[model samples]
Target: MEEMIKLNSDISVFLYDVLTKRQEKNAKYSLRAFARDLGISPGRVSELLHGRRLPGRDLILRIADALKLSPLETEGLFRLVHRQKLVQKENGGARQLLADEYAMVADLECYGLLMLMETEGFKSDIEWIARRLNVTALRVQSILERLERLNLIRSRYGVYERLQHRVTSTHDTPSDVLKESHANVMKHAMEALYNVDLNLRDITSITIPADPDKLSQAKEEIRLFRRKMAKIMGSGKTREVYNLNIQLVPITK
Candidate 1:
């Protein structure tokens, strides 16, 4: 079962490889092209694509819009990159501090909160959040309550602040193991957020019938399709885009 999970994660990582390559190629033709469109810089664009650096929420939204990635796809990309880093660490790549226990901020809501915090630090009033997010104060309050309950943010003296900077466990775990666990958690979270109707049991059962060669072919096909979708959407011609935030998962059951 673990092996099968790893195989699926490997397949997902393969898709991300193609997507990143496509993004890089698109950026190569005109570093200024995306930068101009995004109101950033060629240097920043390079850093974002290759440096494994996290961009601010606004920049992420701008890039996502420029790339024409769907909200779900944007989220998926964040997850993929995060898993990639973990994979690298497992293979003797650079290491970083693990995150302490805190809230799980998934999807757009996470991005929204991060943006507000970045721009305005922390605030306790829902009105402030609503004004910033351009939503009703009631909605902002609900979001804040949810975020606090999730432990993603903490409220003190009516102001909400980010609890931690990282998400993965700091304890010792093999890099590969961390990557695998991260991938599974990300996929699960994404599916839940986007309501992706992936009948996992059905998929596993169906795949079980295929021969090794056929399964390999199918996996490649899926990877190619994901790549194509990513390429087409990331064309930098869209007006609206979503900001995908970073996520990390520990390698523990």
Candidate 2:
């Protein structure tokens, strides 16, 4: 119904956001240029990015191919869109976990399959998932065992499943807090590293007016900066910032 379509729209927007971020990081072409290259209107591309339209399967595949996204990424996007549609049709009572949550579950090997099983009321057990994933029963058992150990999942009647109590409470947490937390973590980590690099370069710069004494002072400052940077990088807890982009750069003097 209409709600289903709206859910589809929301899911489409989420996919668009992921793809757009990837494109922004990797693509050199402007959005208009890229749209032209893909034989679509710029406005249409904008609509897709803004989640005003639900892209068809064919278009989704085409866009994935055009963006050079990996099969995993493409499948993830498709799954999100499909789940959104299902949730919308089901009265929108379920909470929608963001990509980070998906990533976390993926790390535990309990993302896609767990969500599907939960939604479909299937018993999350080795046998059930072994058949679904077309994997060996032993492998599925190992995964379920690990999940149970982490307390992320539990077992009932030999069926393994995510703990219902641990589900993301998106309804209780304000969206702004979630967004701000993510942004702050990503920003601070990036800025910290960037500042370190800049300071190193400043220390290395040898201008005509730079006296020997000033150069020595700069070297000491650089040493302090390097130590501070090392400390920041070594802090395991502080590195929890969600940064997907590679910031490695070759400095040219």
Candidate 3:
């Protein structure tokens, strides 16, 4: 009956809120029902609520889905539960590095899953998403779950919405996740070059020879162009999903 608690950084506290909300909606909703939804045992759910055990990454994601949390709330749940997992590993006298490795590895996802949610005529239907993204329906279903678990999208009354936009991956400190994002986009671009109509896709390139010292200025110019194009793109109604790649590659490197 109270305002939903704003999540910051505590899994036990979050679970408590979930339990309370479930009971409020149905006075008969018991811990066993919560466990059934989470795919965990009732005793285990109680342990989580009581802070006697830390939730595994898989379990935490299941919990998020069971709670039907909004995207932002799901992200907070992930960050908090991940922190708790690390603390749990450390408290067991195990090296914290292992848990930290798990945390880092778990942070990545293929970009397509989230990007497709932004396309025109976006729907929560698995088959629609599969056709739009040119992926298998089964893969689309997996992607939907991944996006929901990562809190990148939310499903409310069977309608899905993207909560965040514009992903930036720094070349300064490369990551496997970042590399994978670029790889997925590049593959799609390659497909467009061969399969898409000339008018439907724009593929262009330029060659410039200049002093290496001006690389910073060149980067700034590219940034400005990207923003300008984004502004132009936003002026019209979005009819379809599009990918824009501004690649600056060295011919001599």
lDDT of 2 by residue, 117-176 (tens): 444446555676777654688977776665454334555455654532223323334556
**Model 2 poorest 10 in a row by lDDT:** 239-248
lDDT of 1 at 35: 62
Hey, what RMSD does candidate 2 come out at?
19.9
Least accurate stretch of 10 residues (summed lDDT) in model 3?
A: 93-102
- lDDT for 240 in candidate 1 is 27
Model 2 misplacement above 4 A: 1-29, 90-253
Report clash pairs, candidate 3: none
Tell me the whole-model lDDT of each prediction, alpha carbons only: 0.49, 0.51, 0.62
Q: Which numbered prediction scores highest in TM-score against the true structure? A: 3
- Per-residue CA lDDT of model 1 for 158-223, tens digit only, reads 666664332333445445555654565456456556553555221221212335457567666776
> lDDT, candidate 1, residue 51?
35
TM-scores, all candidates, are: 0.28, 0.30, 0.56
Question: Which residue pairs in candidate 1 have backbone atoms (N, alpha carbon, C) closer than 3 angstroms, thus clashing?
Answer: 66-236, 67-233, 67-234, 90-175, 103-151, 103-152, 124-158
Q: Of the pair 1 and 3, which is ahead by TM-score?
A: 3
Model 3 alpha-carbon drift over 4 Å, by segment: 1-113, 166-174
TM-score, model 1 to reference: 0.28
